[model samples]
Target: MLIDTHCHLDFPDFAAERDDIVARAHAAGVKQMITISTRVRKFPEILAIAEKYPTVFCSVGTHPHNADEELDIPVSELIELARHPRVVAIGEAGLDYFYDNAPREAQAIGLRNHIAAARETGLPLVIHSRSADEDMAAILTEETGKGAFPFLLHCFSSGPELARVGVELGGYVSFSGILTFPKSEELREIARTVPLERMLVETDAPYLAPKPFRGKRNEPAYVAHTAAVLAETVGVSAEEIARITTENAFRIFSKMPRV
Candidate 1:
């Protein structure tokens, strides 16, 4: 069985046919999915999706793009909200200089707050880093020193140095549909070297659909395509890739019940 470790099934893109999308995912061998949260304030919507689907779980954190709006959302509140049975990880948060939709400073501050919540709750931090590797690594290093916490670089599109540092820091690296791009050979090399025990796969659905399916909306069912490419890149059977990555995901988000 496969699991789309990170997706946005809660997004409006699935509002009209959410059940169909999820049913298709299950039909395609996707046993579970984590509908990631982008803003703490919108957590109810995220949680609602998880509650409605037994195969779905939720994460609670502010995305870097929404950092400014949620910078004031206390870590304690995040911890409190995360106690829910359906909430598994704490984020989709980190720095995103590529967009800079939120001030860089605010992004950094909010990331630190997320780190605090993760450390306090002993829940994994689901991080998003884009064009801001140095600062992201620096903060993760500093925050881990304060207290150990699990974390995963979701839909990772960073440099080898950051990938190296992330694994060395005991964190996992999750690949997305972007890995299937023809120009992503370099990223594929990195994926190849990632230890199987510390690697994962995601679709980041409603965006970044894999090749043949590229330039189109993505969803959990397409994670199989990404996994097939990863299996070829990493020299493993797709079934093996499915088993291990699913196990890695469960290890990071222990709060999520196995399907």
Candidate 2:
């Protein structure tokens, strides 16, 4: 069985056929998925989606792009919402200098707040990092110094240093369809360095679809493609990659029930 540890099921892209999309994931061997949150205000929509699907779970927190808008959301609020039975993680939050959609300061603040919530709730923080690797690593290192908290670097596409730091800090690294892109040889090299026990796979769907399906609307079902490439990159069998990543997902998102 495979688990898509990151996706956006609440987005309108899947509205017309959300049921079918989920069924396709199951049919493709993706047994579980976590519909990630991008805005704390839209958490109701995220939660409703998770509530609707027995195998779908969710996280609570804002994406860095919307950090400015939700800067006022306290760590307590995130902790409270995460208490829901279906909420398995704390965020899709982190730095995104590539977009700079929100103020960098606001993004940093939001990230720290989410980290605090993750610490308090014992839920893994689903981090979304982009070109801000240095700052992201700095914050993660500083925060971890205060007290350790579980986190996963979702959709990882950063430098080797960030990947190294994440693993050194005892965090998991989740790869998206980006891993399957022809030009991602550098990324594949980075993946080679990360420990298999600390690696995960996600689609970050409605966005990055892997090769053979690139330029298409991605869904959880396509996660297998990324996993295949990851397995090949890390010199493991397809089934072994699936087993290793699934186990890593369960370990980080411990809040989710095992199948």
Candidate 3:
């Protein structure tokens, strides 16, 4: 069974035909999916999606791109929202200098606060860092010193240096459909270097669809394409890639039930 570790089924892209999309995911061998949260105020919508679908789960926290909007969400509220049985992770949060949609300082503060919530709740934090490796690495290192909390760099597009820092800090790295892009040869090389035990696959669906489907709307079903390409890049069978990555996901998101 395959697990699409990061997806956004809660987004409008799937609103008109979610059941059909989910059915396609099952047909494509995806057994479960996690709907990532981008804003604290929008978490109930995320939760509603998860609760409505047995195979879907949810994460709670703010995305770095929306950092300014959720800046006021307290550590207490994050912890409270995460207590829901369906909320198995915390974040889609981290620094994103690539867009600069939110202030760098605010993004940094949001990341640290999410880490604190993760430390408190023991839920793995789903991080998204882009073009801010130095600050991202520094914050992860500092947060680890305060208290170790589980986390993973979701849809990782950062440099190899940060990938090494992530593994060194005892975090996992999840590659999304972006890995299948022709220009992503370097990212594929980085994927090959990350230990199999600390690797995962995601669709980041409603975004970044893999090659052949690159320009289209993405969904959990397309995770197979990313996994297949990653397996080829890592010199492993697609089945092996699916097995290990799903296991890695379960290991980091300990709230998941053993299957």
TM-scores of the models, in the order given: 0.99, 0.99, 0.98
How far residue 251's Cα lies from its native spot in candidate 3, in Å, is 0.7
Report the lDDT tens digits of candidate 3 across residue range 77-144.
99999999999999989999989999999999999999999999999999999999999999999889
Which portions of model 1 miss their true places by more than 4 Å? Answer: none
Worst window of 10 by summed lDDT in candidate 1 = 139-148
**Global lDDT for candidate 1?**
0.93
Regions of model 2 farther than 4 Å from truth? none
RMSD of each: 0.7, 0.6, 0.8
Predicted candidate 2 versus true structure: per-residue lDDT over 219-249, tens digit per residue: 9999999999999999999999999999899
Worst window of 10 by summed lDDT in candidate 3: 250-259
Compared with the true structure, model 2 gives a TM-score of 0.99
- Residue-pair clashes per candidate: 0, 0, 0
